[model samples]
Target: MKQGIHPDYHKVVFQDSSTGYKFMSSSTKGSDETIEWEDGNTYPLIRVEISSDSHPFYTGKQKFTQADGAVDRFNKKYGLSNN
Candidate 1:
């Protein structure tokens, strides 16, 4: 058990970088950024690349790659044809 050697665990805001969704949680992660939450209080801000808001699996927007012509892209890259 140590005292000063331990990092502080406190409330922080995790913002989805792509979607701008904010969520409150506690962590040992340190940040120099700050954000004002809906509760009218400021918390340490952490930017994340992805979260449940924009994830393909969670949003059911998962593309099988066939629906968006991604397969065609694959074919083009490998010198193949859709036909």
Candidate 2:
């Protein structure tokens, strides 16, 4: 509640780098980049790797990862014959 003790809280644009999804929210984080939002106002831009739009969990999708040689090891360990 004290002045000059807290970081500046203002409108910020969080963008998903992979999907190019952008949203506006209030944040105290600072950025040198600026973006003109749909509201015709400029806001600090923050780039994020993942967001709800492209996230597998949020989108109810599963991400497939290759096990490489580990797959054979796992199968052998559990005696799971790969027929």
Candidate 3:
């Protein structure tokens, strides 16, 4: 509700550096780089290292480590029999 107290929020294009995937979103961040979007409009270009396109979780390439139960881990650590 206050004026001149908030950061400038505007549309920007985020590019995934590794996958080269791009999408437009609004943010308070700004950059000197610019890009021409499919809509024939130019927006600030923001480069990011990872996005949903290249993320392991979204791409189903994530590796999950199987962790043993607490009791099993304790027994294994102490070299004690399960019985």
Candidate 4:
């Protein structure tokens, strides 16, 4: 518990630049831009490139690649078979 030594933590609005999705959360970061939140209050606006809304993983658009194991790769490289 220090006095005035920590950065100012306040509520800010984070907006996804690609999807225009916005959500409010607490952050130590500050911004000159402001936005009106759904709560009818004005807060600092922070723009982000990606969020849950536009993220491939969150949106279930991510590609899953199955990588071959070492043994499988070795077997494939040569003419070796399990039998």
Best by lDDT: 3
lDDT of 2 by residue, 1-83 (tens): 78889887888999999999999889999799999999898889999999999999898898667787688889889999958
- Per-residue lDDT, model 3, residue 15, is 100
Question: Candidate 4: which pairs clash?
Answer: none
Model 2 clash pairs? none
Return the lDDT, model 3, position 56.
99
lDDT of 2: 0.91
Candidate number that wins on TM-score, 3 or 4? 3
How well is each residue in 1-83 modelled by candidate 3, as lDDT tens digits? 89999998999999999999999999999999999999999999999999999999999999886566776888888999957
lDDT of 2 at 22: 96
| Lowest lDDT 10-residue stretch of candidate 2 | 62-71
- Candidate 1 is scored at a TM of 0.66
Taking every candidate in turn, the Cα RMSD to the unseen true structure, in Å, is 5.7, 5.3, 2.0, 2.6
lDDT of 4 by residue, 1-83 (tens): 98989998999999999999999899999999999888899999999999999999999999876666766888989979989
Clashes of each: 0, 0, 0, 0
Better of 1 and 2 by TM-score: 2
Model 2, residue 37: distance off in Å is: 0.5
How do the residues 45-76 of candidate 1 rate in per-residue lDDT, one tens digit apiece?
99999999989999999966555577667778
Candidate 3, residue 72: how far the Cα is off, in Å: 3.3
Which candidate, 1 or 3, would have the higher lDDT against the true structure?
Answer: 3
